[model samples]
Target: MRQSLQLIFTLAFSWTLVSCQTAQVKTAPEETASASTGQADPSRQAAAPEGGVPELTEDIVFNLLAGEVAAQRGALSEAYDYQLRTARLSGDATAAERATRLALHMDKSELAVEAAALWVELAPEDLTARQLLVVMLLRRNADVPVLEHLKAIVRISENKDENGFLNVMAAINRELKRESAMELMRKLVLEFPGDPRGGYALTIAALVDKDFAAAEREANTLVTDHPDWPKGYLVLSRVFLAQGDKAGARTLLADAVGRFPDDPFLLSAYARLLVDAKELEAAYEQFLRLEKVEQEQGDASYWLGLIALELGRDEVARGHFLRLLEIDGRSDVAAYYLGRIAEQRKESQQALRWYQRVEGGEHRAEAELRIVRLMVATGESREVFEWLQRMRIQYPDQVVRYYLMEVELLREHGTPEQVMALFDTAIGALPDSNELLYARGLYAATQSRVDILERDLLQVIANDPKHADALNALGYTLADQTNRHQEALDYIQRALALKPESAAILDSMGWVMFRLGRYPEALDYLRQAYEKLPDAEIAAHLGEVLWVTGERQQARQVWQEILDKTPESEHVLEVMRRLKI
Candidate 1:
C-alpha cells in the first residue's frame, strides 16, 4: 500500500512540474536578466529550473509533496519545515525561496532569516534573494550581515548604480529604527564617498530623524558638490522648509526653477510653494509652464484648475478641468470640478449631469450630496429623500453621514417635526453612533427642548466621556436656558480642559461665568472667543459683556461691525431687543 501511494504521489508531482514548465519557460528571460545585472524584478517569482527537470530523489519528492499538502491544509509551519528540507536536499533555489516566503507569511522571523540565507547561498547572483536576506537581517538587527549584503548588492549592480544604494536605503528606513537608519545611511555615504545618491539618502534620513542641522549640512554639501543635480537643490529646499524658513525655501526653489526651466519637478515644487504663500497668479503661471513641459499633464492640469479657481478665472479653470477629463484616473475629479463650475454658473441641470458622472473617487459622496441639494433647490424634495435612502443602502460605511445629511435637508426645506422624527429613526438604527446623538442634542437645544437635549447629550457623553463638544453644548444650554450656574461651570471647565483652544468652549465658559455673575472673568473669556472666531453669536456675547462692564460705546461698535457684515444678524438683533438698546 505504501509503495502504491508513493508511486501515485510521484506521478502527481511530475504532472505538477509539467504544468509549471510553461510558466518557467516564460519567466527564464526575466530571471536571467535580473541575475546577470542584479536588478530585481518584483514580478519574477521562483519557478521550475530553466535547464529542465532535475533528478528528484525520493526524499525531494516526498518533502515537496508533503509541503504542498500541508500548505493546502493551512499548516504553514509544517509546510515551511518540509519545504526547507526539500531545499536543503535538492539544492533548488526555487524551493529555498518558497520556504522563505512561507516562513515570512507565518511571521516566524528566525525561520524566515534562516530560509532567506539559504536562498542567497543557493542563488548568490539573484539580487532579490540578497535583498530579502538584507531585510530579514535588518529585522533581527544583525547589522554586520546586513552591511555585508548591502555592499554585495552594490557590487553586483552594473557599475555600482545608485539604484542599489537607494534600494538599500529604502529597506533600512522601513525596517530599522530612525536612529539606526540614519547611522546606516552615514556608513553607506562613507563607503561610497563620491556617490551623490548616498549623500542625498543620508540627508533624507537625517530630515526624517528631525536632525535638521545634520540634514542642512548634508543637503548643502550635496548641492555644492553636485551643482547640476536638481534633486540636491530639492533636498536643500526641503531642509529649509523643515527648519521653518518658508521664505528661504521658496527663494531656493524659485532660483532652482530659473536654473532648470524645463524641469517639471522644480516647477511643480515652486508652484506649490507659491500656492502656500497665496500667490495664486504666480502659481497659475508656473503650472501653465508645467502643463507644457510635462509629458503626462494630468497633475499639472489639476493644479492649474485649482489655482485658476482660486484666482476666480472660472473659464480658465473650466478649460483645465475639461482637459483633465481626457486623462485616465482623473475623470472623476474633473467631473466633480465641472459640476462645481456649472453650479457657479447657475446651470443646475448641467451641474447635475456632471455630478452624476462622478461614479467613484474621494468626491463621490460630496457629488451625491450636491446632487441632493440641487434636487431640493429645484423642488424635487421627495426624489431627494428617496435617493438618500438608496444611498444609505449602497454605502453602508457612510450610513450615519447620509442620515445626518437627510436631517439637515429636512431642517432646511421640510419642518422641525420631520427633522426630529428622522433623528429618532436614525438613532434607533445606529444606537452606538455618538455623532447622531450629538447632532440631535444640538438640534434639541435649538428648539428649546431642554429635556430631550439633556437626554441625548448625556447619552453621547456616557458613550465617550471625552466628548468635548457635547459637554460644552450641554453646559451652554444650562447656562443660557436654566439657572444651574455651578453645574454648568463644572461641565464647561471639563470641556475647556479637553479643548483649550476651542472658540466654542471659550464662549461657553464666558456664558457660564456671566450666569455666575463673574462679570470680569466673563468679559475676558468672551473677548478671547470673539478674537479667535469673529462669529455673530460670539460678537453678541462679547458686546453684552462689554455693555455690562460699562464699555457701552465699545460694545456698540462691536455690534455695529458685525451688523454691517451680516445685516440681518439674528443673534445681534435678539441681544439688542433684550437689552432695549
Candidate 2:
C-alpha cells in the first residue's frame, strides 16, 4: 500500500510539471531567453503583485494541481477523481494515465478499468497505454476486450523485443485460463512469427498446457532459428530435464557449451549437470574455467569452493573462498567455510578470527556455535561463557536459543545436577518457552525421570498439538524406558504424520514398533530412517532391528559402519552391550 501511494505521488508530481509546460504560464519568456546568455534578465517579481499567487489558466492545469495537492495530502481517491475529471473534460492522455494508476493504487479496479480505457482512447498510438488497458481488462476477466487490447499492444510493437511480449504473455497466463492464454499466445505467434518472443510465449503456453510434444517442437524450432539466443537452449533443456531425461538435457547443454564455449550460462548448466551426476572433478574444472571467463560473477567460484570442500581438498577450497571474498564482500559464506577449514586443521585462534569475521547472514548462528565448540575444545570454559553472555545481549531475538545451547553444553560436560539446576533456572525465567520445556523433558528422559518428562512434554503438546519434536521425544522415551508400547506408538505416529521426512521421528516410530513386537514393520521404518540419517543412534536402532530379525551379519556390518564413523559413540557402546555382538 505504501509503495502504491509513493508511485501515485510520483506520477502526480511529474504530470503537474507536464501540465505546467503545456500551460506556458506567462513567466517572462523574453527575459528567460536573455538569461540563457548570462545577461541580467528583468525581475519577474514586478510582473505580479507582491504576495500574489501565481494563476492557473487551463481547467486541465487546475485539475492537475488539485490532484497533486490531494495526493500529497494522502487523499488518493480525491486525487483520482480530480485527474479523471481532467481526462474526461480535456481528453488528456496523461490525465487518464494518472487516474488509472491512482485508481489501481487504491484497488478500485472498476475505476481503473474505466480510466485505462480512456487512456487508450485519448492516445491510441501509445503502446504502453494500450498494454495497461489490456491488463485492466484481464483483471476484469473481460475476455473479449482483453483480446482486442492485447492484439493492439502486440500489433504496434511485437517486432521490438521478445522480452516485452514474453512479459505480457506471462501476465496473461496468471490472469487467464491456461487454454485461453495458450489460444491467445498461439494467435500472437501466428501473427508475428518474425518476433522470437511470440514463439517463446507459444512454447511456454504449450508447456503450461502439458502439451510437451508441442512444447518440444516449438522449442526446437526456436533454438534452430535463433541459435545465438541462450534462453532458447535453456528453455529446451529445462523441458528435457522436466521430462526426466537428464541425459538428454546434459547432452543439449554440452552441445551448447561446445558452440558457445565462452557463454557462462551454458558452462554453468553443464557444470551443474556434471555435479548432479557425481562427476565432481569434472564439474570443479568446468566451474574454475567459468570463473576465469566470468570473474565478476562469484557464483562459479563459490561452487568451486563448495565442490573442493566436499572432495576434502581443503587447501584448494580455501583458495577459491579467498578469491570469492575479494569478488563479493557481501557474502559471509566464504568466512564461514574458511572458519571450518581452520577448525579442521586445528588452528583454534585462526578459526575464531574467521568465525568472528562472519558479522551477519545465514552463517552467523552456525559460526557462533562453532566458536563455542572451539572454546570448549580448548578448555577455555570461562571464555565460552563470556562469549555466550555477549551473544545473548547482542542477539536478543536469539537469546532463548543461546540459553538452550549453553544448557546443552553443560548437559554434555558438566555434572547432571548442575545441568538440571541450569534447566530449572531457564524454565523459571521463561515459563512459557516450549523449547526450554522440551530440552528439560529430554534431559529428564535421559535420567529416567518419567514424571517430569511426561509433565514437560505434555505441557508442550497442550500448547501446540503439532509440536513434532516433543511428541517424538515423549514417544521414544515411553518406548525405550517404559513399557507403554501402545501409547508410545500413538504419540510417535502423530509426530511422523506431522513431519514425515524427519529421520528422528522415523527412528522413534520404528523403535516403538519394535517394542510392540511388530518386527517386520519396525525393520522397514528403521532401514528408511538409517538411510536418511546414518546417525549413531539410528545405526544402533537399525542394527538391533536387523539382529532381532536373524540378520546377524548385517547387524554387525551396521555396527561396524557406526564404529568406523564414531569409534567411541555412546549409542554404539550401548548397542554392543544390549545386543552382545
Candidate 3:
C-alpha cells in the first residue's frame, strides 16, 4: 500500500512538479488566520507518521476523495483547492506534500510556500521536503532563507560526498539570479576551500560571468589540485573551447591523456575534438583506443562508422554499424546508416528491410522517403504510389507532405495529365491549400496552359496576397510567354518587395526588365541573381543579358563557365542557339 501511494505521488505529482519547479523563491510565512474566514489556520491539527496516514475524520476523508476525483477529471484548480482543504484539516505531511505539488502545478507560489513549509515542519528529516522548500525559496530570490537552506544542503552533502553538493549547484545554477548566484557560489567556495568541487563551481561561475582570465586562473588551480580527476581537465578544456581556442583545448586534452592514458572519457574527449578538427585518422585511432578500454560503449562504434563512411571505407563502415545494431537494438540511427550502405551496394531489398526496422526518430521520415525513392528506382512505381497512399492514411499529420511527394514522383515518371489528376484529388481534400494551388499553378505553366496557370495562381494570391512564389511565377509567365511586359513588371516588383533577397524572383524581375528593353537595369538584376544562384539556368540568363549589353567577350566567358560546369545541359544548348553563339 505504501509502495502504491509512493508510485501515485511519483507519477501524478513529483514528475509534473520537477519539470517547471526546478527552483523557486521562498515566500512570506502562511497567514495565521484563514483568508476565507477569520478563524485560525487549520493545518495545525495533528501529526502523522512518515509512511502511514493518521486517522482522519469524515470531512477530511471526503475532501481527499474529492481531490483525487477532480484530479482524475482534469479539473486541476479544483483538485488543488480540495487538496488544500484536506491539508489544512488533517495536518498530515502526506497531505501537505500533495498540496505543495498541486499549488506549484497551479503556479500559486504563496500557497505552495505555505504547504511546503508545513511539510518540512512535520517531516524535518525528509530531504525531499527540504529540497522542495529550498527550491521554493530560491524561486522568490529569498537569498537569506536560501543561504540557510544551502548551508543545510551543504552539510547534508558533507555527510554524503562533496561531489553531490557540486552537482546540485551545477544543476540548479541556470535558475539562479546572476549576482546572487555568483555571490552564493563564492561564499560556498570560501567555506569549502579544500573541496575541489567548490573550486570547480567557482570556475564555472567565473565563466558564466565572462571573466575569462579568472575562469582560466581558477580552472588551472582545479586542474593542478586534482590531477587525477577527469572533470577538472574537461572543465578547463571547455573554458578554452568556449573562447574559440580549439588548439589550446586539444593541447590541454593531449597533456591530460598522457597522464591518464587509460581513461576512456579522456580519450573519448580527445577523439571528439579530433573529429571537430577534421583530423579523421587521429580521431579514428583515439576511438579505437577508447573502444578497447570501454567495450560496451556503442557511441565509439557509431562514431567509427561515421568516420569510415566519410573516408569512403564502406566495408569498414558496414562492419562497425552492423556490430552496433547487434549490441543496441533500439539504434534507429545505425539502422538508417546501414540502409544507406546497402543502397550503395545495390542491395535494395536488404536496404528496405533495414529502413523498415526504424520505428520513429529524426531519421524515420527520411528513411520512409528513401524507401519510396528506391522502390521507384527498381521499377516499382505502382507499388510506390500505393505505399504512399497507405502511408498518407497511416500518418495523417504527414498527409500534405505525402501528397507533394506523390506529385513530384508523377511529374518525373508519369504524364502531365497524371500529375494534374493527383493535384485535383489533393485540392478537393484541401481546396484552400496554398502549397497545392502553387504546385498546380507551376505545373500548368510548364504545360503552357496560361489560362489555367493564371487562374490557379490568382486563386493562390487571393487566398494569401503575400505569396511571393506565386507572384514571381505569374510575372515570369507573362514576361516569357506573352507581350504583357508592364503587367509582368508590376507582379515581379511586388514579389521583389516581399522577398528582396529571392534569387528566383530577382531573375524574374531581370527577365521582365529585359523584355521592356531596360538593358542596364536588367543587367544589374541578372548579375545579382547570378551571384546568388550560380546554377545553369541563372548563368544562361546572365550570359544573354551580357551579350545584349555589348559585353560580348564577357558573355562568351560566362557561357563557357556554364558549359564547363554542366557539359550536357540542354538548357545551355538552347541559350547558345537563341543568342546565335
Candidate 4:
C-alpha cells in the first residue's frame, strides 16, 4: 500500500510538471520555447488536458523528474542523461525534444543528433523537428539523410506559403561544404525539376563553389526557360564576372536592364559594373533610374554622391549626401563625405563642423586626422597638439597611429628638431613598436643623421627580420651617405628577393648599383622601377643613369615629363644641378 501511494504521488507530480511546461511553451519566445518540457502540438494539447502526457511508468517518472530537477539546479549534464534515457524508454515526442534541446545546450552534438532523430521519427509532421534534424545531420556531414529530410521539408512546405527549398538552401549554404552544397542542390533540382527556385539555388551554389562553367550552363538554362525571371540574368552576369570577363558581364547586364528596365537588382548591378569599368557618366544615368525604381534610396544615393565626386561635380555630390543625412545609419558616412566636399570647396569652418558630426564608422579616424590638418592650416597648431594628446588618452589602442599623425603634422608645420623630439617621446612610450622605429629611421635619413638612421632601422629589422621596407631603407641610406656599396647591395638584394615587384625596393637596387659604378645595370633597374611607379624621385634616378650611359635625349625627355607634372620636384632639380645640365 505504501509503494502504491508513492507511485500515485509520482504520477500526479509528473502530470503537474507537464501542465506547467505546456503553459510556458505556449507563452515563451521561440528561442526559449525549447527550454520547456517538450514541443507539444496545439492539436495534441486540445485533445488531452494533460497535453499528451506519456504513460508514466516508474522509470519514466523517476527519469523525467530527475532531469527537470537537475536542470533547475544548473546540472545540465545530469539532466541531459536522464532526459535522453526518458526519451528512449518512453518513445515520447516531448521527451525526445527535451533531450535534443538539452544535449544541444550542452554542446553534445552527437547526443543531440541521436535525440533529434528520435524526435523526427515520432513527429514527422513537425517542421521545427525536421529543421533541427537537418542541422544536426549537416553538422555530421550525413549528406544522404540530410537530402532526404530536405526533400521532406520541401514537400511539406509546398502546402504552406513559405519556400522550403530556398530556406534549406540558405541554411546549407552557411553550414555545409561548398562542393557538398552544390551537389545537394543539383540533386534537389533533379528531384523538383519543375521548381525554378531549385535551379537558381543550384546556380548560386555552383558559383560559390567556383565551378564557373557549371554555373554558366545552369544560369543559361534558367534564363532560357524563364526569360521573365530577372534573377537568371543577374546570376549569369555574376558567372561571367567570376571568370574575369567583366566586359561580358557588363554587356549581359546592359541587355538584361534593357529587358527589365525597372528591375532594381538588375539596374543596380549594371550601374555598379559601369562604375568599375570607369564609365562614370553612364553609371550616373543608370543610378538615377535605380533611384526611381528602388523604394529605399540609401544605396542609390550613396553611389550617386560618390560618382558625382569622381566626376568633379561637388555641388551635385553635396546634394545627394545631404539627402542621405536624413536616412538612418547613414548620418556618419554622409557627414564624412560632406566634410570632404567642404574641404574641397575651401570652407574650412564648414568642413570642421561636418567632420565633427562624424561620430563613428570607417571614416571617423580619417575625419579626425583631417580635422587636425585643418587646424594646422588655420594656424591653430598649438590647439591641434593638445587635441592629439587628448585623443591619445581616449583611444589607447590607436596611440601609435596618433603619434605617427603628430609626426607628420610636425614635419609639415614645425621644425625638424620638433619632429625629432616627438619621435623620441613616442619611442619612449612604445619602446617595442617597430612602426615607430621605422618611421623615425626614415625621418633620420631625411635629416642626414646616418648613425641614428642605422640604429633605428637595425632595431626594426631585429624585431621583424622580414621587414623589406626597413632593409631597403637601410641599404639605400648606406649607399647614399657612406662608402658601403657591397653591404648596400647585399641588403637590397635580400629586400628584392622578399618583394620582387616592389617599386621602392627596385629603385633602391638601381641607386645602389649606380653608387657601385654599374651604370648599365643601374639603368635597367631604374627603368623597371620608373615604369612600375612614375614618381619624381624614381624618374630622377632613371634620367641620371640614362645621361651617364650617353642616352642624353631620352634622359631629357624623362626629366621634362616629370618637371611638367611636378614643377616643385626637388629630386629632379637637384639631379640637374649636380650634373650641371
Candidate 5:
C-alpha cells in the first residue's frame, strides 16, 4: 500500500513538474514581439545576422526572434553566444534561460557554468538555477563547496522524493564531511516528517559509520513507513552481507526479489551474488532468466558468457560474446575476453586484432602485456625486450610479466653475469614465486651447473615433490651428467607415476632406465611414449634404447626413419654412425 501511494505520489509530482512550467510564469518573447509589432518588416524578417541580413533591433523582441531563427537552423554555438549578448543587454530571464540550456547543448561547459551561475546569482532563490548549479558540479567534478550548495538546495526544496533526497545525501556523503552530511540529513528529516527519505538517509549514514544497530533501526523505520518499497529490504541485505552472514543475505535478497520480481536491479545483484559463490550452473540459469526477460541489457549477455566460459561451454560462451560485441562493439571487456579465447586457440593474428580494439581503453595495458608474452612464446621475442625496457621505466614496482620475460631473454642470449643478474632480480623482487624458482633450477641444470641445480631442485621438491616437470628435469640431468643412476631412477619413477601418460615424462623415465642398464624396461617405455607422441625427442630416445635392447638392426632402421623426414636428427645420426651401423 505504501509503494502504491509512493507511485501515485511520483505520478502526481511528475504531473506537477510538467504542469508547473505554467506555474513558473514563463514570459514568452514571441508574444511580446507580436504584441509590439504593428506589421512584419520585410528586411526585419531577413534571413539571420550571419547569413542574409541583420534584423532591425528595436528592442529585445528583435534579438529573441533572431536568436530563435539561428537556433533552429543548426547554429547552436552561435545561437547561444547571441542569446547571451541579448540577455546581458536587456537582463531578460527568458533569454538567459535559453542561452544557458543552449550553451550546455553545445558542450560549452565553461560557458554553461558561467551562465547558470550568473542566473543563480541574479535570483538566489530560483530553484531551476540552483538545481542546475548542483548538476554542473556533479558533471564537472565533486568538491566540498558543491556538497554544501546541494545541501542548501535540499533544505529549501519545496518537495522531496525518495530519489531526490537520496541523490543529495549521496553527493553530500561523497563530497563533504561524513558527520556533516548525516547532520544535514537529520535536519531534513526533522523538517519533512512525512517523507521516508529522511529515515533512509539515516540508514545510509549509520551504515557508513558501521553502526549496524542504528542502521537497522533506521531501516526498520523505512520498512514500517514505506512497506511496499524494496530499497529498505535491499539495504538490509547489504547489512547482512557486510556482517558476513551469507544465509541472512540470501534470505533478505529473496524477500526483495519476491516483492520486486521485475526489477532489473534486484535480479542483477542477485545474479552477481550467485556468480560470486562459484555456482556457475545455477548462475547461468539466472542469467538465462534475466536475458529472457530483458534481452537488450549488456550485463545480462556479459554474465551469460562469463558463466558459460567458467562452465567449460567454450563454443556457447563464444557465441554469446560475439552477440554481445554485435550489440555493443566497443565494449572493452568483451574484446579482452575474446582476445584471451583466441589466444587459447593459438590464433595469434585474431588474438592480436581483438586485443588491439581495446588498446586505449581500461584494458589496454593488460592486453599489451599479453600480446608481448604471446610474441615471446612464438620465438618472435625481440619486441618484448623493448616493451620490458619501457615497462621497467613506467611501472617499476608492479611486477607482473617483465620478470619472467627477462629470465626468458637471459636464457635465450645473455652472459653468465647478466643471467645471474636476472636471477638476483627475480629473487629479490619475488622470493616466493614457484615458477621463478623452477626457472632458475632449469636454467642451472641446462648449463650443467650441478651445485645450483641441486640446491634449487631440492628446495622445489621439498615444497612440491610431485611437480612432474621438476622431477623430470632433475632426474634427466642427474642420469645424463653423473653416476647417480639409482637417484635418477627414483625421481623418474615418481614423475612417471604422477603423469603416467605424459609423453615427455615417459621419455625421461625411459632414458633413466636405459642409464640404469635395464634395457628391456627402457625399450618398452620409450616405444610406448613414441606411439603416444611421435616427436623427434621420443624417436631419438626409442632408437638409443633399441640399440641397447639387442635390436641393432631395428635401432639402425629407426634412426634412418627419423633422418628420412628432414635429415636433421643429431642424436639419431650419432647413435647410428657412432655405433658403426
Candidate 6:
C-alpha cells in the first residue's frame, strides 16, 4: 500500500506539470492574438521570456512588443524608448547598441542623438558613433552639438590623429571665423608638427590674405622638414614672386632645379622662373634639358627654336624651326618665324613662299610688310603696287606702311597731278596718321629746298616721338650740313633711345660727335656701329672716324670691306685714296 500511494502522488505531480505546460502553451497564442488586435498598449499582453510572467504589468515588455511594430511603421521615438527599456532590463550592451543604431536609422533625430550618446557610453572608444554624431551635428549646423561632439572625439583621439581632427575643425572654422579656424589648426600643428598638410593649411590661410612673409616662412619650414618634396619649395618660390621678391624666388627655384634635376614639375617651374628673371640663357639651357629628357623631337625642337628667335639667334633658330616642321607638329608658328628668318637673310623669294603659305591675321602682317619692303628694297616696287592697293582695302586700320610706300612710288612713277590724285584717294582713309606725315617727311627730304622737309619732319616727330628715321635723318642732316651741334645731339639721343639696336641710329650718334669735334667719342660710337652693322655707309663713316683718330690700319680694313661690297662706289674709293689702301 505504501508503494501504490507513492506511485499515485508521482502520477498526480506529473499530471500537474503537464497541465501547467499545456496552459502556458495555450496562453502564448492568446498573448500573440491580443498583441495582434491593434490595441494601443498591445505589448502589455504579449508573450514574455520562456516560462516567465505573461501579464500586462511590465512597461518594458509593452514597449518591446509595440516598439518593433512602431519601428517598422517609422515611429522611431517609440522604438528608442522600447530599446532603452529592453537594454535596462536585459543588461545587454551589444544588443542595446544595435537597437540604438536602428533607432537612429528610423528617422528619430532626438532619439538618435540620445541613442548615439548611450552607444558612446556602451563602447566609449567607438570611432563610428563619434564620427557619425559629429557629421550629423555638422550637417544640421547645430553648433552646440558639433562643438560637444568634436571635443569628445578630440579627447578620445590619440595625438597622431590630432591633425586629422583639426582638419575637420579647420573646415568648420571656414564657415565660423578665423579665430576658431586658427585655434584648431594652431593646436593641431603644435601637437602634430609632422603633418606637412597641416602646415600648408596654415600657409594657405596666410596666402588667402596675401601675407607673403608668413606664407614663405611656413612653406620654407615645410621644405626644410620635408626636403625630398618639391611642392614645398615651389610654394615658397611662388609666394616670393607674388611678393615681388623675384630674385629670391629665382634663387629658390634654382636650388630646387639642382636638387630635383629630372622632376618635370620642378624643372618647368624653375625654367619659367628663370624666364621671368630675364635669365634667358639659363632658361634656354633648362628648356633644352626638358626637350632632351623625353627625346620628344617635335616639342623639344620647337621650344629651342622659339627661345633662339627670342634671343635673336635666327640662323641657329631656323634649323630647329625647320626640324620641328619636319616632325609635322603645329608648325604654323615655326613657319612664321622661318619666314622672318628668310626675310632677314634677304631670301625674298623663299620668304614670300613661306609667308604666303600662312593664312591671314596679325601673324600675316609681317609677311605682307616683307612683300612690300623687299619690293622697295630691290627696286621692284612696280610689282607691289596692286598688292599695296589691296592692303588699303583690307586691314585699313593697321596697314603697316602700304599708304606711305604707295605715295613714294607714285611720286617716282606718276606725274605731279597724278600723284596728287593718288594722295587724295589714300589720305582721306588715314587722316592724322603718323605714316602719312612720315611719307610726306621723306618726300620733302629728297628735295633741293629744305622748307617742306623741315615742316614735314617736325610734324612726323610731333605725331610720333619714336619715329627713329625722322629723328636720325633730321638730326644727321642738321649736324652734317646745317651744323646745329647741340640740337642735333638731342635729336640723335632721342633716336638712339627709340631704336637702340639700330646701327643707323648709332652711326648718326657717331656722326654728330664727329661734327662736335669730340674725336675719341666719335670714334667710340662709330666703331660700335661698324661692328654691329657692316654696311657701306656705316663702313665709310667708321673709316673716316678711324682715319681722323689715327687708327689708319683699322680704317684701311673698314674701307677695304666696303670696297669689296661696292667696288664702283665713290665713298669706298675716296676712303681708299685717303687711306692709300
**What is candidate 4's lDDT per residue for 50-124, written digit by digit as tens?**
444445554555566666666665778767766766665455677678778988988988888888988888778
Off by over 4 Å in 1: 1-53, 67-81, 101-112, 123-132, 135-145, 152-167, 173-180, 496-501, 518-547, 550-581
Per-candidate TM equals 0.81, 0.79, 0.71, 0.77, 0.45, 0.43
Ranking by TM-score: 1, 2, 4, 3, 5, 6
Off by over 4 Å in 2: 1-80, 88-98, 101-110, 119-132, 139-142, 145-162, 201-217, 527-536, 551-573
lDDT of 1 by residue, 186-297 (tens): 7766787776777887788788779999999989999988899898989899999999999999999999999999998899999999999999889989999998987566
Selected candidate, larger TM-score, 3 vs 5 = 3
Model 6 residue 179 CA deviation (Å) reads 25
Candidate 4 segments exceeding 4 Å error: 1-80, 86-112, 119-145, 152-181, 493-501, 510-534, 542-581
> Could you tell me which 10 consecutive residues in candidate 4 have the lowest summed lDDT?
40-49
Which stretches of model 6 miss by more than 4 angstroms? Answer: 1-262, 265-301, 304-332, 337-354, 357-363, 370-384, 404-431, 439-452, 462-469, 481-509, 516-542, 553-580
Give the distance in Å from residue 417's predicted Cα in candidate 4 to where it truly belongs: 0.7
Pairs of residues at least 3 apart in sequence or in different chains that clash in candidate 4: none
Clashes of each: 0, 0, 10, 0, 0, 0
lDDT pick, better of 3 and 6: 3
Question: lDDT of candidate 5 vs native?
Answer: 0.70
For 1-581, candidate 5 gives per-residue lDDT tens digits of 01222233245345544553343323335533332121333333323344322232444343444455556556677567556555544444455677789878878777787778767764565666767766775567643256455555665563542245665665556544666667666765766677666687688778888988878788888888887777777777677777787788776776787778776766776777888788778778777777766767677888888888888777888788888888756468888888988887889888887887774677777887677767777776777777687877787764545676676666656687788788877777777666777888888876789778877777788889788888888888898889998998888889888999998888888888888888788888888888888777778778877776677787767767778885977777666666676
Give the winner by lDDT: 3 or 4: 4
Once model 2 is optimally superposed onto the true structure by TM-score, how far is the C-alpha of residue 241 displaced, in angstroms? 2.7
Q: Judged by lDDT against the true structure, how good is candidate 2? A: 0.80
Query: For candidate 5, which ten residues in a row score worst on lDDT?
Result: 1-10
Task: Report the candidate with higher TM-score, 1 versus 6.
Answer: 1
